[model samples]
Target: MKRILTAIVLIAIVVSLVLLGKLWMITLLAGAIAVLAALEYRTISAAMKSPVPMWWTIGAIALFFLAVFLRPQDTITAVVFSTLVLFAWNALATGVDRVLGETASGVLLLVYIAYPLTLLPQIWSLENGTALLLFLFLCVWCGDIAALYVGKNFGKRKLAPTLSPNKTWEGAIASVVAAVGFGMALIALGNWLSTNGSGYTRLHTSAPWWEYVLLAILLNIAAQFGDLLESALKRGAGVKDSGTLLPGHGGVLDRIDALLLAAPVLWFVWVVKEYFSLGSF
Candidate 1:
């Protein structure tokens, strides 16, 4: 219990620094995080006895970070094509060693680890993007806290016993409740900060309240899926935790799993909304 509390406080401090710090700092931190997560994922895949080529695994990590720093304006299609081609080549290079199902596993790793982590920094690159990024983190953090607290005490029925044995239906419901409540609070806060003004405020003066709500809800759903997806991955891998880097939280991958998934979805929504001049509400 003490370990959990200490972990929470440390995480809160780190998150506060990241969200409030300069963009470069955030990008650097996120990049480092991406590398660590990629390593953790590679460990899991190796443990699963995946036939992914060593060179391709290394290349995928490189390409992922390249995409992050370059923030390529028109290279998404190129990246996808390149990744697919490399995947095929890697499979072919393995010759008879590559099993029929191993190719799909390689593709899944790229999609799971590479694609999602690439979006973390992209969130900061959009207009009014800081708010969206912060909101994404908040939704995931709130949902995770809610699930933990609710499950530890009030949990009854299992949510997915095969995947996450600790997860419960009560916890899942609590997570949604916490997400919605956090979203509403953030919306209210954003509105208040925009209107009446406040100390240390970075919000745009003309930003609408509805944008906060919409972004929050979208992030919440994505975050939930992210957690569940990670759970499923761990189950498939026949592991308890992604790694033991963190004392109580498992690994960087375990801690940031939801953020990994949510970041990309949030980034896409922001990009589409900005390009189309569509209101977030």
Candidate 2:
């Protein structure tokens, strides 16, 4: 019940934000989420006994996200520069015994959490972006639902016994199937919106159906990998949950783990499609 309620509230918040259809709103939302997730990550790091420099890590996260909106070129620079700073700080502060793990954890948080979140606003900046972002959410949502349903019912072969015992091969396949099905549903909705929505652009279907199927598989798998990755992080840190930020959801990191891996791929697909002038993503 708590999980269901949390899902509903989360969907409401996300849909409301997306309906606002403003890049700033998305950026702000993503920034807020990034900060919270970073703090949770800090908690996890501390649990592992490798604390990231709080101010430096948080400041770098904010800066990289800002680059997501202000200057695309600066985004890469921000990450590279932040990484160097983190490494140097670790070397100076923690000394040799803990420097390697500390530096690696700090840098990984930048790439793993901050970087992918930057894509949320980037996706919003593209043509038919609102729809694409919604579709991305839908894909992840449906994939998760399907994984849960199928895994609970038929999951026998352990996908990763140590990291996430609940996950299974059946769940993974179901996630892909569910994402593809959601893609087809999006195609239907796009056709409807194209006919009825004046000035409201929907994601175009210029590519063949197979292309979309492939994209769905990629996204679903990426999201699954993200879930597994987070599980690994928690397990490695010897913690069951990242934080209690969200009810029934372990933490902000737990909730957005799928997006961490999924967003970069989604952004990349949008970029490639735009670069080729291939219709709306």
* Highest TM-score model number: 2
Looking at candidate 1, the ten consecutive residues that score lowest on lDDT are 197-206
Kindly report which residue stretches of model 2 are placed more than 4 angstroms away from their true locations once superposed. Answer: 197-199, 202-206, 274-280
Candidate 1 structure quality by residue, lDDT tens digits, 1-281: 75588578866865675557776676666656766776777667767776566566666666666755765764475457656766577556655565544566666766777777667666665555555566677788888899889998999999878777788889887877787788667656665776774653443323466666666667777777788888887777777778787776778889888887787887677668668987643
Clashes of each: 0, 0
lDDT of 2 by residue, 1-281 (tens): 99999999999999888867578888888888998999999989989988888898779988897887888777889888888888888778777889888888888888898888888887766766766777788778899999999999999999999999999999989998999999778866775677785644545445566777777888888999999999999999898988998888779998889989988998888778779987665
Cand. 1 Cα-lDDT:
0.70
Error of 1 at 183 (Å): 3.0
Model 2 gets an lDDT of 0.84
lDDT of each: 0.70, 0.84
The deviation in Å at residue 23 for candidate 2 is 0.6
Candidate achieving the largest lDDT: 2
